[model samples]
Target: MVLRTARVGLRLTRGQRNRCFGLLRAAGDVWACILEINSWRRRRGEPPVAGYQQLCRLLTESGPGTFAELDTAGARSVLRRYSDAWFCAAARRKAGHTDVRFPRRRRALMPIRWYHGTFALDGRRLRLPTAAGCPPLWVRLDRLAPYPCETIRSVTLLFDAGRLWIDITAELPVATYPAGQQPDPDRIAGVDLGIIHPYAVSTLDGAGLLVSGRAIRAEHRMHLADTKNRRKAVAGRAPKPGQRGSRRWRKTRRRARLVEARHRRRIRQAQHEAATSVIDWAVKQRVGTLSVGDPRGVLGLPAGRRHNLRLRQWQIGRSLAILHDKAALAGIRVHLVDERGTSSTCPNCRTRITKPAGRTMRCRTCLFAGHRDLAAAFTIATRTPGGVITTPAGMPAGVVTHRRAGRHLPGAGRSRRDPRRPAAPGSVGRLRPAPPPSVGSRSSIPPGMDEDPQHTTGKPGER
Candidate 1:
């Protein structure tokens, strides 16, 4: 199915607002009840239960959280809607033999509800069904509510920053042009994932591109400082459970959550921008496929006193996942190459090099040198076109190949090589830290990596 999503702003009436709130309350109640049942199981030394259907039946029969505005029918329906994810981690814990810890419940926001249907769209307001007995409550369609589209599968209502909004996700149909037109293999781009330069870019043309998100580190530092300050202030007189609802505690909690949410929003937006930019360039260059470095291995490194502060700011794997999805849509291919020794191995001589200085990688064996990240990207981009990065589950057939070369941080050498590292055939050695290139050095592009005129290939796997 081809799904597309569009956000349509709403103009809601007061009654509609109340109804929306009622719907949210109902959803929250369902989640709370699920959590409560799991908590009961925990206390009884029994395994927690998964699924919200049973709970939905119970809630429907019990007639809970159904106010005048949030009528019984709307409440039950809303409860049933978001039930798939109700148990989540609790269910995992139950299956894994882990003890379940009950979550605290918050007071319900009253009089809100949501309706899904062939909601009649009349200008800004959407008309949806309500309880049979009561007159329908019309909500003021505002920034929070948007007219639902046929393309969307579901809409999630979120209350944040003292306001309510709906997050709509639509499944978009993949764009198809012609078969046999795979991206050009010659103009490949090597991308180095990093904290400072979130994207270290080097195309087959030897041009360098740096997409940086340095402000993220600073924001994280501020958050850390604020967290510490709050921690120290509460150290001497940590409040009990009931006392947590104190004004000061509530204020601090809200502030902390706001800061965290802001950080996440910024990081997510940055990743989207970076991924879009890279994908656009690849499509334009008609690069046949991409060999991206997998840097998530850096996450397991100890968060000790010597930790790299830069590591905490970015999620390289997440960015790559977004890139991969977009590349598929653009009909560009990506390969995950083994990142082992990618930064350390000389691109020219294939000799392992020890990184000796800041942001610089030098080949001790052949004296070949380059910035560390670009070298890894180049190495990945230069791999034989057919190579695939093997994962624990053997490579699935029919997807485009993207090399998976991972970076080795400055302090990572003392530990033994991780067995789970990507298994690429070329250069098997220790990875070394490489310095970031000076702002404007001419980056060397890998051979056979360039954008050529489109050569039609087979159609992408059907949805």
Candidate 2:
């Protein structure tokens, strides 16, 4: 079984919220205590108490009720977090990364986790483990847990964007298909990741799928504009460093957090939608292996500010992670291949060509032209490690299937307008009606004025 985790918001009363934060604060205190103990050891030229067993012993020696409302299992999870981080940093440093640092900084709040037996999940309600003498803390979830109770392994309570959330981790079995329709191990597809098209997949059978990300890009642009406007509006009210903020400023900060969270949720939802589309397509095609192009190498280069912002919004790592997780659940294999020359090299002639300015790539050597991303996918499909490319006959055909991600986005529909936005400049709602008829209108003017006296008195050119 594979492990998966889903984060869901918590619905809590004012008292419950405060209690939850108190538990988190207790976890933070535990973390600080460990750090302080280790610091003392360092000062005395002795080995630090970084081992989990030693830390548990230290905790036991401190006795009960030291951390209010925090149970042993919950506190141990904090120690586990620290131990894991410490080892991870040590391993990285050993591997020639000098910048990796062990966990030393203290936090005001730390997430507390409880194993399955320590907590109770009843439909939408969860009973968190507290200290022995404390009253039972039962909190409601904003929505029912996605996984079944039997599959749930642990729950972690944390705060994000000024709101409480719980990450529910569960073990899930890999998807099983019917006997005749199981994924074929030999069938492989190539995935080309990009900014405009998050996923461009091409199978060995000449079929291709393109998941457009225009809506996602639009969401990013609109969110950036909204954030800029908000910051400009609140700049004057923002407190200086070391100064306490007024209630109004705090409210603005909260609003900003909500907006940022909303934007993140929207983007994450769209990315999942895109990855789901790819997986569904793969399953339908009976494709088992996906060769994904890794473009992270180019990220370290000195790109301009605008390009950097674009790359940051692209969120290549998150895209890959979602794709990998979904693929694993579907019993599909994912391989990350270097994508250095995939976009520039022509698939037909194996000749290096300039990267296309638009989405269409043309090969002057062979006079072959097609969608740039699709071409990259086709090329990436043949690429294997050790600088070898295996090309099957009749590969990289012209047939392609197009799909769009984030169709649920506000501006993704045919209207091309977000419902939350005001009418555009030339739209019907914003257009002004023509001016009323002038004062010389026939109905409002006198009869003589309407007849034009000078013309009438001319007597038909008699002079």
Candidate 3:
């Protein structure tokens, strides 16, 4: 079995919202107290306490009601968060990363978590454990849980993008297929990751699949332009370095944050759709293994400011995670291979060629021409780990299946970004239907206009 998480929003009344925020602040206080203890230890030249058991003992000694409306389980989760962070930082520093620092910053709010047995789920309602002698805190979910209640392992309550959400994690079993329909381990496919096309899959049989991300790209571009305009419009109202922001400025910042969150949600949904398409195609073709190109190694290199922004918005790491997680659930093996020269190398002759600036790549040595991304996928299959020379004579893109992502995003219509492309079905801001022409010819005038039977300026039988 593997673990998965889905975030579901909460449906709360005004009082519930305040209570939830209070719990978060309590968690933050718990975190701050831990940090304060470590600070005193540092000042006295003594070792800081970070062990989970020791911290729990310390919390018990402080007595109950210390964190109002926060139970032992909830407060312990915060302690666990701190201890984990400290260990993670220590490990990093021990591994030659001296820049890594232990947890020291104070936060106004922190997420609270409840284990499987600590929380109760009833359809769309959730009962969260609170401090002793306090009424049980029950909250409603905006939507039903995606996973079976029995399989749910934990729930984390956190505020993000100006909204409250609960992350529900569950353990699920891998998919199983009928006999003869199960994917063959020998049948492998290669995946090429790119910004324009999020996923390009090529099999050894010359079949391919390309999931276009043009809509996602346009969404990012439009959002960027919109954000720039908004920022410029409010530049005069922005607070100085030492001055506190006015009420209007605070509202503007909140609006910006909401917009940013919405943009993130749209992009995330589109990426998931793209990944799902890849997995569905692989399953249809009985593909057992996928060799995905790892491009993160090159992300740290300076590629100019414009390209850097483009790369950052590309969100390559999230794409990889989405694909990997879905592939795991589908019982498909994935290998991440170094993708340094795959895009420029000739698939037919195995010779290095200059990377083309366009979608098509031409190899001078072999006179080969094909979709650049597909060629890279084919070459990536040849370099899959745990296998030697698995790729056959590389073929140009053929019998390819095409799909698109981000159809539900705002401004997905043809006019918002590209005039040539039609709007995606079910997209936001779809154009209105064309209206009847106002101007009419003499032979086809409206009935109310110049309607004379004997000397008619319009056609006869106007009805």
Candidate 4:
């Protein structure tokens, strides 16, 4: 539940940009040189090296280098950054991976200038040391805090769209659960993840909620196609390994690079929005227990183009990650139950159906007809180890209600009419409250009438 907020980029003059780049390049060069030196050593019969301060000094003692000299703080920070990178690389290698690839000086590579403890924060500016025998550099801010400045560890300067920007890394704070919430034990929710529908939630109450993610997938594909075209155009042009910068070559390279970055960012934002909406709905429903089918296995199968397309639309893993994380913060329990035969098996009857084309799903044995996603959701919702319903346990607390339906005499003679007698204390043995008069629906209640505090049926304001 930790939240990260960023302030818009601050406009920097050309001089300021150069200074920032100077500090950034100094740091990048330190890391790059260290990596190269380590590679060379590994090639020879020499041990791998560690720590870059001594190496930094040796590289810039009295040479015609980009950086005139190295300061103690900058030198130390560079070493620490590379050390962290080395640890990460080691972890990846330990997981049966091969050699590590050091980061290159790409357009959007890390541009960290200030260290965690070395840089001092003025009222509206940050100051850090750099080489090149220049004065200490300062990053001026328009306001004291455009975002939660306290959370930010450091800001890295970056060049994007011919404009300078800063990428701020911050320690996001966790959000607390709201008041008067309890976990619902009796109710379970099944989610059918898809690209077109995004989320198809079938609650114990038999209500289906469809949250469309069409725009999200469409935007992502659009950007992806644009990127592909740009890459193709770049590939068509020929260039030598050490050719000097040409107008067309640089222009195409820059365009391709920008498209790549923008497209990734667009996809990220869409995912955040889609996941947020799904999580919000789950929270509102007070869903104590949630089960999302693992579609990744199916997606990995060698299928036809259309099948693969549908599978791609189902970002089940990503959506599930969002649910799990949000539910953890909210204290709701989430389970990754076996999704095998969830859609094929009927919830009402244990009969399995063969794959049917199009969107409708009809249980051959039970004759239960419903939307395919809704049917899958219902099947998922009905599954549990024991038939007995209990309160859900996990992240995000909520309340639960039990209900049952059975035949009753139309006009049975009774000695005395008791209001509480109809409810039967334990299970809500009856239908839901009839639709409001305005809706012009039947007075008969729908099956599984227990209300969900977190999510409600046909609630106009529900988002």
lDDT of candidate 3 over 243-291, digit per residue (tens)? 9989999999999999999989989999999999899989989999999
TM-score of 2: 0.88
Clashing pairs in 2: none
**What is candidate 4's local distance difference test score?**
0.56
Off by over 4 Å in 3: 240-242, 386-391, 413-463
Best by lDDT: 3
Arranged by TM-score, best first: 2, 3, 4, 1
List ranges where model 2 is wrong by over 4 Å: 240-242, 385-387, 394-398, 415-463
Candidate 2 vs candidate 3: the lDDT winner is 3
TM-score of each: 0.63, 0.88, 0.88, 0.65
Model 3: which residue pairs collide?
A: none
Error of 4 at 1 (Å): 7.3
Q: Write the per-residue lDDT of candidate 1 for residues 1-463, one digit (tens) a residue.
A: 3333333334555766666666666556655666677788889999755545665566667653354434554455544534534455457677884755434454465223344452343444445545557565443445432323555554444565545654455666655555555476566666767765566555544444444344444455555776788778866555686665567767766777876776566556657766776776566556767777777776888777535655655666687878788877776777765566676766666666675455556667655555566666666666544665221221111211222112121111222122123334453454323334444342222222111112111111110
Q: Write the per-residue lDDT of candidate 2 for residues 172-266, one digit (tens) a residue.
A: 99999999798887788889999888998887666777777777888998899989998898899989999999999889889989989988989
Worst 10 residues of 3 by lDDT: 454-463
Q: Point out where model 4 deviates above 4 Å.
A: 1-8, 47-109, 113-134, 140-147, 158-164, 182-188, 224-245, 288-290, 304-337, 378-463
Cα deviation of 340, candidate 1, in Å: 2.6
